[model samples]
Target: MSISFAFLLKHIRPFGTSGYDTFCSVDLANFLIGNLGLTLGDIRVLYTAWRGVALSDAQSAAIIDCAKDVANARWGQLQQTTGSTVMFLSGIQLQDLSNASLGQSFTWRPASKIAVAVRIDGGHGGHHARWDVEGFSGNTDSQGAICHFSDLV
Candidate 1:
């Protein structure tokens, strides 16, 4: 009933599949929230930070451990870095996805470094310390809310 390394290896398209190399945080959030019982607030916050970070399925038990850690810590898990699986999630209009190498430990946790006065919120209006802020919606406390800081933002 588990997604084993062997299963992952078997499914990993002769390194063939185009965009199936990793999992997105959005999906992860849905799964964790809907199925795994991870705290919605925890997942939502972590999801907001990375959103689309490429989580390499290449790690041994990286995905599994991620779920466990999220359940245990329930807070302060944003910059997780287990093996090639860096905790930065990103994908189309989201974070942009960053896949891991192969067989690594996953990690997660964080505290927002955004200076409210300086950074934009909910696409309302304002500039981040660096990137343009856009696309993000809902109030800061909304579970669906996300901040996009990019050149195009």
Candidate 2:
């Protein structure tokens, strides 16, 4: 039960497919603000970035995509502290869900993580150097793991 574009679209009263042409990012953001309480400017930025690049429907879809990404990222962060029961739309490792025809299902539980350290030094001299260290605490090797998938259909 993940939040989807269609689900979000249902929230706005008069925002069916036909509304795309007349409504810009600002209008969409305003629509979402009442439900998600997101910063209008932030969503406007995302909408403006893709504005005029495609047809009206595509632009509207892009804004929805942006909102979905933001929500998913936050959900992922929450999973770090408290594990979540996530549904795999495709597949993970030993299990294959991609080819499920209709009333088929597969369950996959995969976990892994890796630590990393990075250093950058200026070519001119050692005077300018930067170091990045991650996964320094609490099961660093299992900190983050993503389910790999692809749409072959």
Candidate 3:
């Protein structure tokens, strides 16, 4: 049997420190499953981060560029199959509130949008978090961007 979006969201909640992040991820997942009618097993989640990289202009650009490409590739594959796609970015970057700005700079085609937030740790460890959704229009063009809070519940 396929897993429910809610179930998956609940299972992944502990990893996120913000309700907004969790909401975004789950909402996008639900959108993919409910609207696109894709099975849960068909969905895949990928996590990546650049912790040890040097803090330089080129490094930041390279990291952001790589991330954008990864997001695009994953969504593109999903569009080829289910005509919709959702991606979540979670890890050490979420600790700083400023990280959300990164989402705004990333590009999403045909209405694709990204959801993002920072998960700060007063004393605990910190991480960065994000969610993105890409939906294909009839002509296989991408559609509206929704950034939800459910990604980090």
Candidate 4:
């Protein structure tokens, strides 16, 4: 059987931490399924290649990008088959609370939107976190953040 989106997201690691362009595992998974025409089994192989191996960030990005490029060459567009609603929230950077724990809670008002995949970047501060419409969690070097939300409607 084919794997589900949620399943892929949970399996992949953080894209930025994994040497991707500030993208998390979920985003890459979306790209693979949404942008690239990759099945879950196909993706699992990629993950297996680097699960325990140590490679530079550039090398990792190269591998993933190569796969992405191949998919693009084969498929014209990676359209969502499920017709899910995607909303990207830019300029919604917020600061973390003082004396907060790792994965602290913070809030950002959205334009009446929900999310399926969320990514937060504490730009310049090198602090990255995960967020939703309601709240978020993670440590920050500064009080700045960038958020992207994909609603799985």
Backbone N/Cα/C clashes per model:
28, 1, 25, 3
In model 1, which runs have C-alpha deviations exceeding 4 angstroms? 1-26, 51-153
**lDDT score of model 1?**
0.27
TM-score of 2: 0.25
Better of 2 and 3 by TM-score: 2
For model 3, what is the C-alpha lDDT against the true structure? Answer: 0.31
Lowest summed lDDT across 10 adjacent residues in model 3 is found at: 135-144
Predicted candidate 4 versus true structure: per-residue lDDT over 1-153, tens digit per residue = 122333233222222222222222555666877666888887777655434221323234443433333333323344322122212222121111112233212343334332222222212212112224443322222333222213222
Per-residue alpha-carbon lDDT of model 2 for 69-116, expressed as tens digits?
Answer: 433454544432121111111112112211221121222222311111
Candidate 3 or 2, higher lDDT: 3
- Tens-digit per-residue lDDT, 37-119, candidate 3: 76666444322122211122322343333334434444444432221122222333222222222232233232223233233
Query: Could you give the candidate ranking by TM-score, starting with the highest?
Result: 2, 3, 4, 1
Span of 10 residues, lowest total lDDT, candidate 1: 7-16
lDDT of each: 0.27, 0.28, 0.31, 0.32
Give the CA lDDT, 0 to 100, for residue 17 in model 4: 27
